[model samples]
Target chain A: AQRVTQPEKLLSVFKGAPVELKCNYSYSGSPELFWYVQYSRQRLQLLLRHISRESIKGFTADLNKGETSFHLKKPFAQEEDSAMYYCALSADRGSTLGRLYFGRGTQLTVWP
Target chain B: DARVTQTPRDKVTEMGQEVTMRCQPILGHNTVFWYRQTMMQGLELLAYFRNRAPLDDSGMPKDRFSAEMPDATLATLKIQPSEPRDSAVYFCASGTGTGTNNEQFFGPGTRLTVL
Candidate 1:
């Protein structure tokens, strides 16, 4: 079974508009959730983590236990925000233990 | 300016040939991870090491793929008898794997193409 799920493969938004990328996960106990971003010709970098409870580049994510979701949100989309976003979780057991299980990723494009 | 570095940024090989990719993790980092990114499956963890010791490689193909950390700074992923399906970008990430600073720093990645 897939541990992390990001439903949207592609999303587009206008500049200055709000944008949200949906992510959901399944885990029994507490899990560490993180969002990573990759820009063109660049390496993947950490955008933010739920544990840190901080926002980066105007983006924030909240982990909802009841819904099992950790959605990334931004108030205003910028052209620089146009990149691939991946939702990931670190498990505590088996193959996933101490390692991250990443979602397929959502490519967000912000149009001017 | 400590960052993960990978060698052979791009590789073009033939099917059934052996392919090897190398990574140099950030100095003092305790964990190193290998991942494969493709159009269909996205990013998949192939293997990971903690403190220069292999912790898990279950995500890798048992017969064809092998991963190892020769030292704290060096990690390698090798594929024997490569297939066209093995073509993808391979990334190596390094992190402290400790409290509050578990964020992984990624390398530029090795783009492989098998013909």
Candidate 2:
């Protein structure tokens, strides 16, 4: 079975400190990984995707196939960066195409 | 800007009542997805449609839940005889469905409460 795991339910960091939100997945085939963020009173939006290999809001995630991980990281955490983050995976297969499997999510808090 | 839209931002109903949630996908999007979000379960895909056809509904409960896309622009998820356990935020998303570019755009979501 395909699954995405975000072990930490809450991650707290001081402002300007580095932050890492761990995410791991178990899949038999190649998977598309994404990080979605939901800020307070705002709708969920895509933060970044592994396929893009680009950073969003100073956050970057590298897909490690060998480790089965796609941990999201930021060099300096900001108060505005605090939000609920979810790691998601999608595998293209018949009947399952366009379906996304999401992790339980992590609530990141940046304390000033 | 293009975005998926859902109706009834919030709903409160009693048990055994019928609940219907609607979604309008972003124009030109080929795929629409329904997801249930809860604190415990996180996000779970309920159903999805491609090109206005029912592709898969295995994630939904067959006995009381039904999902349909009346057209390319409109999709609906209906739960008959809703239970307290069914209370959650329902999110609708749209995507191009093209390989390697299948990023989904989610709607505001409908918050449902069952008494």
Candidate 3:
């Protein structure tokens, strides 16, 4: 059973504060991890992937294998960064390949 | 910029009514996906296609939900005799699996309401 878990339903922070959205996974093998964000009135878009190792809009996520976690982090939160974020996983090789399993999602709100 | 597009951004219909949602994947993308999102479920993948062929629709309700890709650029998801539980924002997404990423590009989605 492959699952993605986002523990927080809602998180709030002030501008310039650091934030972390926690995510955990249960997969048999090395699964691809991703973070998707949906801003208000906008379509969902890829924020970052574990393989890319690229930070988009100052947000970065590191996959920790030991803990089976892929937590999204930002050193300084901005008001524009507030959005609904989802943690997703896909098997690298299997019948379920390319099929994404998404977490329940965490809604982040940054107040100015 | 290339983007996946979905029609009928919003729909309000009574229970047991049939509803059809349309999607236009980005040109040249081989994979298309249909998903339903709700406050309770978050996001659920109903079905997906590759090369205009149905690969997996196991996530969809077999009796009332169906998805088809009539062409490379067009995909549709139909719900026959929809129920109140089916009311949610349905999204269409397209992607090309380039290496290990396979990042999906999503559409604005169809917000369906059932009474």
Candidate 4:
């Protein structure tokens, strides 16, 4: 079975501090990992994908195949970065589709 | 900016009532997905359609839940005889269904409450 696990339900950090949101996955084949963020009063949107290797909003996530983890990290947390973050894994059964397995999500609180 | 759109931002109904949620995918997107989210379950994919045809609905409850794409632009998820346990936020997403990183664009979502 394919699964994404976000161990922390809430992560609190002060501004200028480094933040890391842990995510682990279980899959038999090569997995495509993504981080989606949902802000208050805003729609859920993609934050970053491992394939892109691009950092969005000062956040970056690296997929560690040996560890089966794709943890999201930021050098300096900002108050506006506080939101609900979800780690997802694509089905990747051959075609490009939207059957993504999502984790329970972690709420990051960046306090000033 | 293109985005997926859903109808009835919020709905409250009694048990055994029928509930229908609609979604309009972003123009030109070929894949549409339905997902249910709750505090306990997080997010679960219920069904998905490609090219206006249902490719998989195995995640959805067959007895009461039905998902359909009337056309390329419109998709619907209906739950007949809804129960309290069915209450959750339903999200609709659209994607191109091509390339290596086919990211999905999600709608605002519909909050359903069953009494």
Report the error of model 1 at residue B100, Å: 4.6
- Give the B-chain TM-score of model 2: 0.97
Computed on C-alpha atoms, the DockQ of candidate 3 is: 0.64
lDDT of 1 by residue, B60-87 (tens): 9989999988888799999998999999
Clashing pairs in model 4?
Answer: none
Clashing pairs in 1: none
lDDT of 1 by residue, A3-36 (tens): 9999999999999999999999988867789999
Error of 2 at B48 (Å): 1.3
TM-score for each predicted model, relative to the true structure? 0.94, 0.95, 0.95, 0.94
DockQ of each: 0.56, 0.67, 0.64, 0.58
lDDT of each: 0.90, 0.91, 0.92, 0.90
Error of 3 at A90 (Å): 2.3
lDDT of 4 by residue, A39-98 (tens): 975678999999999999999999999999999999999999999999988876754345
Model 2 chain B worst lDDT window (10 residues): B95-104
Model 3, A14: alpha-carbon shift in Å? 1.7
Off by over 4 Å in 2: none
lDDT of 3 by residue, A1-112 (tens): 9999999999999999999999999998887899999998678998899998999999999999999999999999999999999999977775666778899999999999
- Candidate 3: segments with Cα more than 4 A from true spot: none
Worst 10 residues of 1 chain A by lDDT: A90-99
Report how far off residue B111 is in candidate 4 (Å).
0.8
Task: Write the number of the candidate with greater DockQ, choosing between 3 and 4.
Answer: 3
